[model samples]
Target: MRLSLTPLGVLLGAIFSTAVLAQDSDTTTITDYDVISAPALSSDRIKSEVLIEVTTVGTRLIAVGAHGNIIWKEGDDWQQAEVDTSVLLTSIAFADEQNGWATGHHGVIIKSEDGGKSWKRQLDGFELMTLEEGYFENRIEKLNEQLESTDDEDVIGELEWQLEEAQFQVSNIEAAREEGPSKPFLDLYVKDSQTVLAIGAYGTFLKTEDGGESWQVISGRLENPGGYHLNTIFGRGDDLYIVGEAGLAFASYDGGENWETLDSPYRGSLFGGHLDAEGRVWVYGLRGNAFVSDDKGQNFTTVDTGTRVNLSAGTNTNKGTQLIVGHSGTILEIDDQLEVKNRTHPSGSVMTDIIEVAEGEWIMTGRSGLLHWPAKITEEEALATQQGAQ
Candidate 1:
């Protein structure tokens, strides 16, 4: 029986959680191996590890995955980077050839300066909790002052409600401090060296304008009241797009200063998104579901991908082609004419992310680790390489 990747999020989460919890011993508990302070263990087998996200900085290929593993390739061999944390890194983005950022489990945001060679943790869940606590505390104080000064019933009612919400959030943060940082940052958008957006599960939205020296909680900027998991954030120009669990989508025309929720067609979680040069918005997720919006995400039409495998990640090739990769090694291509072609790898590996190496060539990473796509060789070519000893 073939495993379906329609709901890849739940499947991967279970695998990671089980691995972390199984580290119990006589003298040490699972907490002893806290991902927050633990550095990624050095291993020769990192090339075959379950990598989740891949991207390119110039000619260098970098990928991050389970156990906080981050690897980069420039020539023949892939070299593991010096990472500071062992949390599961889910998304990575580079603003230039020399600067990049990655986000992962435990609300981690790590930055790499000299290409992708080494990374330093800039933010994490513990720090995020503190930031939230302070923000809400300040909000509650301001709201209380407004309530005491206002005489109008309508204004007083609004102030009271805002104060209540802020206080509630503070209480939640205080409680979460005991459990440690559990939320994972699912995706990231690097605007520049100084400004970046890291979003994740449960409407975890954050921004750092001073290059991660200080981060601000910006989840309230979005209209996500239920705090649904934010799965992906990507855009082109000033038009930004965010898609997540329950088919939730948001668009920001003027950068991320403000957001408006878009009406998504599919009700399942959207795992990835792409914004084209022509301003077309493509969002895809569970069950091979994908939609394109030409009018800034106001309305969308389905793109018939001809497959039911979940689409995990996508990219716009340097040659102007659109590609989406997913479970079972499926690859869907959208040409300039909007024609969709779907192809699957013979190995049937679960591909989590893909990036264009050149015009026709590509590199992808996932459960089977990192490898160049179209990896299979013809039978004749294979037979010729297999010399018999007799």
Candidate 2:
């Protein structure tokens, strides 16, 4: 399969805008060598800020978003924690309650040992290029020796071509090394404290067995010959699924070591996916198109959401319903039988991730910042309003 290996943001920028689209969305990360570990600014309005992802760490909720902001739930409040990078962090995953990792623009990866309280950088684009340089240079040396012994002109030419390509790859790594780490990891799934899977644009698939200490690029394991951009990945039990651009999708039954390209239902870009409790695989994306398949993606049926806005985020909440959030403040709830229910929110920004905090309440973060959707008013709040009216 071909490997495009482009920062996901740049592709979106080309479709949206070359200038402010990436900057505003924090979507693409390029070879930027500046590694700043600045502290996040404290704010009373943090809930209204643009957060990208939220995950549960034990009983606490932790979120990461633009400007290296990491927030963890503190009792009934949310508190911002210290982070080492100002790069836009798009996804966060914890292998355990105390060990987790965050991925973002510039091929940045940070580790946290104390839940989400603090983070330390383990790998960046600079070091990644260094590793690739050594790998390609060694391969070129071996190919040169093989070329010296070959007699056939066709064989000689093939070896020479491979030698030249390997050398070219080494030079490319050196050039990108000088530029910095601009590649962005779009999503992550942590299997354990020692295992992780990260995916991104142009078939960027990586696996780490010993946490982030070492990484092995494994894009060849999937059948994505076009190097389709992989957007989101989720798993339930042993079933794993990855949804991406250009109607691309893949499923794996054994963690993520191997994959099977599943039949797609939508021809447009799919932004996110989730595996619900009922063993149903749900995928959503461009326009208002969404699909659910019970037979492990062999076939999927379209869901009528009554909106055309692109769906960006989705999760099966504690309330046993699948909630999907999208552009123009779009929200759709799916029951066990795939019945649709609509909800309203105040924010119109493109929401990236969402989770339920209460029985009927939800907290979502995205383009405009943060939004708290309350399903029902509390009795105390109603009583206070009634007293004030009198």
Candidate 3:
């Protein structure tokens, strides 16, 4: 049997593995040059590059990908945006039309105040690793104190186990310090202009109350003791849901202050999730596995996608349809009744994300970069004319 790594695993391995290393100008010195500080290089071939995620800002479509490239389509053509970092961006979210943020490798979070034209680095892994180290250290100290003060045997046992976990996390933080900033944030949900939740590899969870100005490590809010990767975070109204590696699932009823674990039906990694307009929870991942929960993730039924290819991302259409894109250019359209209609593009590329441009039109990003279904866009001429009037 042939072994294959999931898309999430492949992305993480490419980021942290020692097989690929960066060298300085002389090609000899292993420079500690921070990707967060490095500016993204201008490239004319950005349209043909590997883009991971995309979103719509009003009438504009913005997409992000490798080497911190961010491109947006406003009137006629897709143009590159000014970005501060050179890190590989994995996910993008917008609080509204004007304020947006993008997350990627090295725990990077870039903010865009004017739609998606330009971005400034708001957070990075160096600061994240330091914050995580302090968090674990404090946790260890608190657990030790509790163990010393507790009288009940059951309480003592719980404190002791908590202390061990805190100590282990501290050790992992120390090791990470030596290897530079290796942590990567996979996905994020923009609740509003003031609140955002970001999650990633090794159960990394962070939140920012002041937009992207400052962030706090809040991984303790979840029940992921193994520190599994949190691949996707999404919210509908006050309910927030997170799905990750090994079928781990969590939900928060009152914002993110508290959480409860949900029983996941699939054991394989869940790459992404969707909380539909009808309040249904949909989680999809490896081998075309997908499940939907009608009662707030308490139970789930399988959603037959008809293909065995790994599903990476999904989006909600204006026509009350859900479209999921995955490897081998597979596109599965699930209606309101959970009926699936599958289609494939001729490119056969691994599509990471998709967005509906019009009623029956879509724009997708993947291994082969940006793609248009049916045709490039039948409304391009009319859209250009409208922009001219404005």
Q: Identify the candidate with maximal TM-score.
A: 3
Which ten-residue region of model 2 has the weakest summed lDDT?
13-22
Q: Which ranking of candidates, highest lDDT first? A: 3, 1, 2
lDDT of 1 by residue, 65-92 (tens): 8778899989988899999988778889
lDDT of 2 by residue, 72-164 (tens): 996887888888887777789998889999987667788999999998887666665665566667777888889888799999987887676
lDDT of each: 0.78, 0.74, 0.80
| Alpha-carbon shift of residue 385 in model 2 (angstroms) | 24
Task: Evaluate candidate 2 by giving its C-alpha RMSD to the native, one decimal.
Answer: 6.3
Flag the better candidate by TM-score, 1 or 3: 3
Tens-digit lDDT track for model 3 on 200-306?
88888999999978898899999987888788888777899999888999999998889999998899888878877788888898889998898999999999889
Name the runs in model 3 displaced over 4 angstroms. Answer: 1-33, 375-390
Model 2 accuracy (lDDT, Cα): 0.74
Root-mean-square deviation of every model: 6.6, 6.3, 7.2
